[model samples]
Target: MALTDLYDRASSLLERRFLKNAFLPVAVFPVILSWPILIQSGRLDRLAAWWESLSTAGRIVLGLAYFVVTWFFAAIVASQWRNIIRLFEGYPIERTPLGQRSADWHRRRRTEATQWQHYLEYPDEDEVLPTRLGNILRTAERYPFARYNADTIVIWPRLYHLLPESVQRDVEDRRATLEFLLVTCLFWAAFGVADFIILSVTGAAPWVACLCLLVGAVGATLAYESSLSAAMEYGERIKAGFELHRGQLLAALGLKTPGSLEEEKRMWRAFDKFVRQARPADMEQYRRTSAPPTGGA
Candidate 1:
């Protein structure tokens, strides 16, 4: 395929994936959150009667309006995708008191759990994040650096382009799943809070409001846990992409493929320096006019 066509295909795939991921939270969550208010206010019966009274054409117009509003919200949510991921990843919050305390607590828990040498390895204390989702993804992001001395943040865009279309599809699929789950978790939490507040303000029974809150909390917790598992799968796909296709990446860059593990690590470290600081890493010695062999070392 021509290069421009390939770029267009990738862009189109990404847009579709993003819209799919955005739809549930934008379209479903509002209805879920409004139920308690509707019930508490005794508005559902009135709304149903009103809806039944609408002319067919009026009902069609309302339906169209609902679709347009949901699509608009989805577009806004999709535009803020990076920020949403960061929020789930607990970024700037790490500097806050609550975040610091939570991180320290998690670090201690992991340390205790892994104190025995036979126990499974965990991320280092310094890499621990305030949220479980953040920790799962942080470990994934650090995988290249931890294993190959490659800075994944700097290398991923280049490496992704070099990946096979099948591998790229798998990675994108996993990412979309993770995004969907994270958004669900956030929306469920919002629903629970909104439901509780509406119930209380409308003079609903205290137990009823608490029940709604509990339902929302349970939904959010379940979604969050599912997202953690999704993240693990997504992380593995990413690690595999680097493990299996990194040589292709080097070859595409017109660089000689490293012959040994140590040599590859050294090359990655030097390339990272070059990419991050515009430092001359004497990379010319590694460049080759001929294409390097396919597949990873």
Candidate 2:
């Protein structure tokens, strides 16, 4: 397989997974800080009772301190959780078919697509192999047999759609991956919240609970990165599959592998139009069904 194909596969699979993995810590950091204070809650309650037995001025001072503490926690959780929820609920991109009509899934897809777009758009000279695979994919879309990567330049005489259905299925399977990730993220968020409650009720300080959650979020990122690196194996495999049979995809788009540059550029313009116009409905569907389940960490 060519380097361009390899990059495409890796780009699509890894970027969203990486971001979903990063979101947890942002949600849990405050909770971790509150633990130290929460640990003193019991003793503080006793102290407050004692103060209540003293003069009214003493009780008033204690009440004011409690208000400050509660307000601080509320402010922290409010601001942090909003960002966490937005990450989970992906805002703007959730409005398109490109996003699977689900925020989590949409953000995952949009991020991957945009990341790949960015990666391919740039060139790397310091690496073992310099790359412009993104442009190559576009070039190939317009001019099928055009081989830009040093590793591979072999192209067959074919259109994309003529390839077997199996290849099409492979490309579409990404949607399933999104679904899996969306559900998994929601589950983990809920688990984190539950763990927080369980530990907090046991007299763990709020900060301690927050720390535990932060650790959990970090663990999730590590696991996702590990899994994604493994999953990237698909990138290599699919590239091979596409090249072995490039006809199907090209035909589906009514594209010849090496179509004219002008035609390829124009087609992309059309694609943009379709994406912009139809995305609102897609976004609406996702908001209804794909918003993270109620009550996440």
What's the lDDT for all of these models? 0.82, 0.42
Clashes of each: 0, 31
> What is the C-alpha lDDT profile of model 2 across 1-297, one tens digit per residue?
577976786676544433333333334444544444445455556655776688878778866876566556545543443344334333333445543333343234334465464333222211211112222232223222223221222222232234444564554354335333433444445556766776788776678678667765765555444333333333433455545554343334343333555554444344334354653432231122233232210
lDDT of 1 by residue, 1-297 (tens): 698988898898877776677865788887787877888788999999999999999999999999999988898888877788899888879899989998988787786674441122245678788987787788778888888999899899999988888898899889888888878888888888888887898799999899988998999899988988898889889888998888878877777868888988888887887887887656767777675554532
Candidate 1: clashing pairs of residues: none
Name the lDDT value of residue 17 in candidate 1: 71
Candidate 2: Cα lDDT at 168? 47
